[model samples]
Target: MDKLTKGTWILNTTKHIVDVAQKSTELNYFETTALAGKTGVFLSKLVADKQEVITYEKVKKFARESSIDNNNRNVKMHLDLLKEYGKVDYNTKLTEVEVYCFSNEDAIETTADIYSNEIVDEDEDINIYSLEETYNVPRKREELVNKLVNNGYSEEKVNLAIKIQDTFGLIKVADNILYNEYTFTGNEAKMVKTISNISSSKKKDIEEVINRISNNQGLIENKITSDINPEIVKLMEGIGLIDGITVTSEIGEATFYTSPHIKGKGIKEKDFSLADDVFHKAKILLSCLRFGQEKSTYGRGKIDTRTKMLNIIRKLNRGEWLNPCTAVGQDYKLLEVDGVVRVRAFGNRFQMSLRQKEVGILVEKMILNNSIDTTDDMGDICSLEVQPSGIIIPEVRRQQMKPKEIGLVKELRDEMLTILRT
Candidate 1:
């Protein structure tokens, strides 16, 4: 890639990427993977006026480096998480996510409601495993495989993972990606049930439908177990699935799926695909988790995509790039439109929205804070300040509050109130 031209720097001299990077135990800063975490820790410190930097290149390089290098391994991952969430930050760790689920709003009959079946109701709170739950630890995977193998699992199935790990390393266990093959636990029954119910005239339709939609595997299996009729068995067998799909009748207590890779063992969603850019995007989203104001409907997926985007942005900046800025969440899009990036977390998304419009005011003020730049007059470059006149209380508020203090009566009736009151 061509190095970013010098012209970019002149665009915004106040941008400070070097300081955004965490001080390195090795040299200038911690690797890019650690940037998001550092950014998360210091997010509160950044002000609307201060320039926030997120390095795309060193971060991207660090991601690629961690994937390849075995030596810096200890420093590479957070001990508590024990897995790389592609490139997620500390906030993602704290943010709650949703389990894979389905919408139940359209169901006409309450009888159709199965307790354990995946269903999302409007505004109902649901819990989801974090990205860390979705990913496998590099060390733990090794230990699990060894324990499973020694316990007499078929060498074929156990070694399938072994072969995967040997060639692809950690990616294989986490994503089940191999040479044009993928694997997951307990997906066979659901794949079977869905296929067997196909009508004679709807074979193409059934298969086509199967090509789309990732059913929460556990849900389908739960449905199959509770209502297995003879017809369901025939339907199950025709789809190459055998009976033993275990699920409980327990209706709803909000249990989340533990497995991230399995959609059902035998069936894969052939209809869906993530573009290479999207895949990279997904990777970054997986790396950086959300810290604040992500709802259940958009929570998990948003965190995934955003993490992916930030990591890529951080990586791309490794070369000489312009005075680019990136912030934690969607709350910064308004500020972003003004040629500023908000890489720091700003509490919650709601608070983020509140401050976005004041970017120009904040940037100017931030420039003044550093007091680093000097003008031709030998004074601060942003010497001009807009000190706000104290706000006069509104008449409506004065009427509503009906101040208990006597000072309020004179101040409200005389010195204060909107000009309309006079």
Candidate 2:
């Protein structure tokens, strides 16, 4: 067979050559296959003539003779792959292309050399590149793959590398790449090392702490000692896991709470209260009552209505007496009677109340401790007084007030005021 036809026949028969080209050039399967067909045709001519070098013009001539696209554009595109894979040495400025013998041995050696020589410094900063830009550009893909592989990662790690790149950008990943030894600074590095050193059980414990903090929207870092493992706490501090959270260390110990600005999702400061434990219990009871034995709603597929009701409960449980003006509940209307606060869910009117004596004691303590302001004349009017029938709510005369003033009295209805005094 003639050289051109022989080349085409060899390309069709040998698939491994195309696979090598694909890996070396970081091209997709199809592009590398097409380029391999054209390359095989070109190689046949070089082998037959015993030539090591071909001018750019000769490349086009050979392409036409071999029934490959003869256009300079098509020939140049195919030649680019050969150069990238180190199969051929072609310079953009020079019009000559030097051919290397097509063999798997040569291909592997050359690509490995290229990778070793081009490996980036572990500390080098990588400019952020969007996934689209990296995928579309062959050069960028090769650069990433080479860097990752040369750093001791296998081909299987490519997806993981991409995910890291997407999350922290290439710069952070490069900084975090473990070389001969771990080289990083600050809390994040320390935390990573700490996590690596701990047992799997401890790791799970740490994760649980994070989940609890996340679920509670946040907690005082000090108050977090209850269920958390101490080793995990050390790791957390090392990693600055609670960075950007609200920190209040004055009240005996450092308190770390969630900040809406940082975590995107966390409990707002206003949503938390001393009665959080009680609110949580009440929420569980209500959810259980509403969902009953239904498996779906009780688990991962919980309804939004349940979530909203829990939030409302949290807000109401902030130890604030719900007068008519501020008694707005998203899915429920709140009622205070005899020192007990009741929540009636809007739909189905599902009702639940806090422990009556516990709530009354808390409210009384708050008033006596002056934690809640009772300085207004209205406060004097409703001041707590010891009576035979329990703490009695002082009366406000309707006739002594103007029309708008009467509305204020009406808002603080007898039942709500009675709860406050009691």
The prediction achieving the highest TM-score against the true structure is: 2
Alpha-carbon deviation at 357 in model 2, angstroms: 36
Residue 240 of model 1, lDDT score: 20
Q: What digit string (tens of lDDT, one per residue) describes model 1 on residues 1-422?
A: 01111111110110122223235332122133123222221121122222223242322333332222222343234212212221223234333221111111111111112111224221110000111111211223444445555655544554443443233221222223211111112333433443455334434433432332233211222333343332333232221222111111122121111121223232244522211111111111111112111211232323223233233333323321222222224323322322233333434421112112222222222122221222322111110011111111111111223223234232221211111111
Candidate 2, residue 170: the lDDT equals 23
Query: How well does candidate 1 match the true structure in TM-score terms?
Result: 0.19
Task: Supply candidate 1's per-residue lDDT for 234.
Answer: 28
- Which portions of model 2 miss their true places by more than 4 Å? 1-125, 130-199, 226-231, 237-244, 248-253, 257-422
Against the unseen true structure, what C-alpha lDDT does each candidate score?
0.24, 0.33
Which 10-residue span in candidate 1 carries the lowest summed lDDT?
122-131
Tens digit of per-residue lDDT, candidate 2, span 137-237: 21234456676567555645554445433332221121222110001111133334444454344556655665554444334445466766444453343
